[model samples]
Target: MRPELEPGHVAVVTGGARGIGLAVVEALGARGVGVLCVDHPDADTSAFVAACEAAGVAHAVASLDVRDRDAVRAGVATAADLGPVAYAVNCAGVDGLHPASGMTADEWRRVVQVDLDGVMFACQAEHDLLAGRGGSIVNIASMSGHVVNRGVTHAAYSAAKAGVIHLGRSLAVEWAPLGIRVNSVSPGYTMTAMTATNPPEVNAGFAAQTPMGRLAEVEEVAEPVVFLLGRRASFVTGTDLLVDGGFTAW
Candidate 1:
């Protein structure tokens, strides 16, 4: 673990209750970084609490909707209460698969609001908290942002994720002088609570599309995210790390 991620430092992770977000929280905790796990109001925090206890790190859970700017600001403020917030992972996102032609305005807005706008809101709040102290931020994007999925018809999801990837780059430049680094991680098809609910054939198709011949584990995505959040990636900013098992390469 890098010194930047050591004890006495804290992190704020949105969507920390499950999936890739939970994995990032666990990874940060293992590095002795106190964590503030922020998830939706109704998200279950049992797993997050267990991970923190096992790692023996100071921890708190905030029920926050990343779509709300005020709520996101308050969440970051709460994390600061734990310790010096050195890192943040914006993992709160949603995906809606609907063909563009038939997609209702409401459906498109819902996905964009949660995926792109939510990430922006969190980044804004995080930037304010770490303005002078220097910190790193990782936003969770998707391979869909780089390439269209073969059998999926989710134009809105793809567009939002693309926005997230670019947003990180734009902020990285703006915040660099302030000592804050911003980056994004784009994961390929991954095994998660939500994807686990899909039919076997559906998952198999996703795996078949990838050169790796398998979906990514949540840990795989979290590892790169943690890397970008630490000093190891000190010179790495204004970029998107693709943790997609070469899914985008093909």
Candidate 2:
């Protein structure tokens, strides 16, 4: 293990089954950090564990839904079995687009419940994990939290992510005294499974708007997220690391 990370130090990553979440898991594991991969109960975790092991790292898997309060708390305890969870990333979320005027109550509630509420739940659960060791948390937010998109109707998503950004800042201040740091990583349009469902034309449209002239890759976003969780970001807290392709720069 690295000097900054002890033998038993572990990282708990939500939505670790795939996409940006899985990318983060691999990044941490490759660095010899113990990992607790949490995702849906039915998600295939064998590949993830194998990948970690291939990198000469310890790994554990847990079935959980960030929306379930009890599950989130228990999931942390479960992860602690591997080691002290000194690093955590709240990356579990749902993706959708619905205009506010036509959005159904269920649609709005579901998005917020998973995106915003799940983050809060995960944070509360990880608090105990970092109580003694002191740690860092990085919540995966989105650019929608800052600016609306051209074709995607992300009204609900925007509102929920906006909440995540603010909540992370608040927690950073509250946990600073305890030697714990909290921050958010707001990625712009990223090319991942989550965005794979969009129409090709829609994706192209977003590409046109971004200052970088393209969507971010999953690895690109994961790199910054892992950076925030590492010792390199020891003094970084209560801030949002924008990994967007300068989507909001305009």
Candidate 3:
């Protein structure tokens, strides 16, 4: 059974302007949770705010670069002012695909900074607000973190995602006593703006390898995140939830 939505809960989602992030925002809003959509400065953030308004859920948008510590702190503070931040979903990340031998140091740092360091900063900024009340944190990792994707070379992305899983696990251990649950959702080839950049044939190849024989819909992955953030997974923490269409089964 699906868990019931409780009123007075607020959820903050990074990268909430589009793709999987937007799907997560809609999901949380559908469950009656107030939402704060955080996106980069140039993104069309007004759409997110408009959607929330249409849904009749309280909402706000903050332009933030998760890599900026001060910006993350201020963004979290702004969200907290709306209500107790009961949930945080860190979905802001970048993908760098290059041959390991030819990858540049800057390329590596860019992926790691957004995918790994950014998650840590967002979580840390919201830690105090979630402390006494206990909240849920769902970090968006990737199936690449658990298995090698020989078709695509993304050494930096995979490495940073691996770090994300460990970061969530460690935070779970430290925050469980305070009632805060930290978990991760690792999605496989899903149909999102990120994956949309891939050549059609490339996406098809990934679909063929999955047991489910198709790429995932945005909502397919979003639902898992909603579950993790809701009461249904009250006992789940310090673990990674794989929504990969069985891609890792082999």
Q: In terms of TM-score, which candidate is strongest?
A: 1
By lDDT, the better pick of 2 and 3 is 3
Please provide, for model 2 over 1-250, each residue's C-alpha lDDT reduced to its tens digit, 9 standing for 90 to 100: 4554444578888888888888887788767788888788877787787778787777887788778989888877787788777899989899767778999999988999999999998899899889787999999998889888777777889999999999999999999998889999999988887778889988889899999999988899888987888777889999998898889989
TM accuracy, model 2: 0.95
Q: What is the C-alpha lDDT of each candidate?
A: 0.91, 0.86, 0.89
**lDDT, candidate 1, 6-34, per-residue tens:** 67789999999999999998899888988
Tens-digit lDDT string for candidate 3 (1-250): 6445565688889999988898998888888788888788878877688778877888888898888988998887788877778899999888988998999999988999999999999999778779988989999999989988967889999999999999999999999999999999999999987889889989989999999999999899899998998898999999999999999998
State the displacement of the C-alpha of residue 16, model 1, in Å, after optimal TM-score superposition. 0.3
Provide the lDDT at 10 for model 3: 88
Task: Give the Cα-based TM-score of candidate 1 against the true structure.
Answer: 0.97
User: What is the Å distance of residue 171 in model 1 from its true position?
Assistant: 0.4
Clashing pairs in 1: none
Predicted candidate 1, C-alpha RMSD? 1.1
Candidate ranking (TM-score, best to worst): 1, 3, 2
Give the runs in model 1 whose Cα sits over 4 Å from its true position.
1-4
RMSD of candidate 3 to the truth, in angstroms, is: 1.4
User: Scored by Cα lDDT, where does model 1 land?
Assistant: 0.91
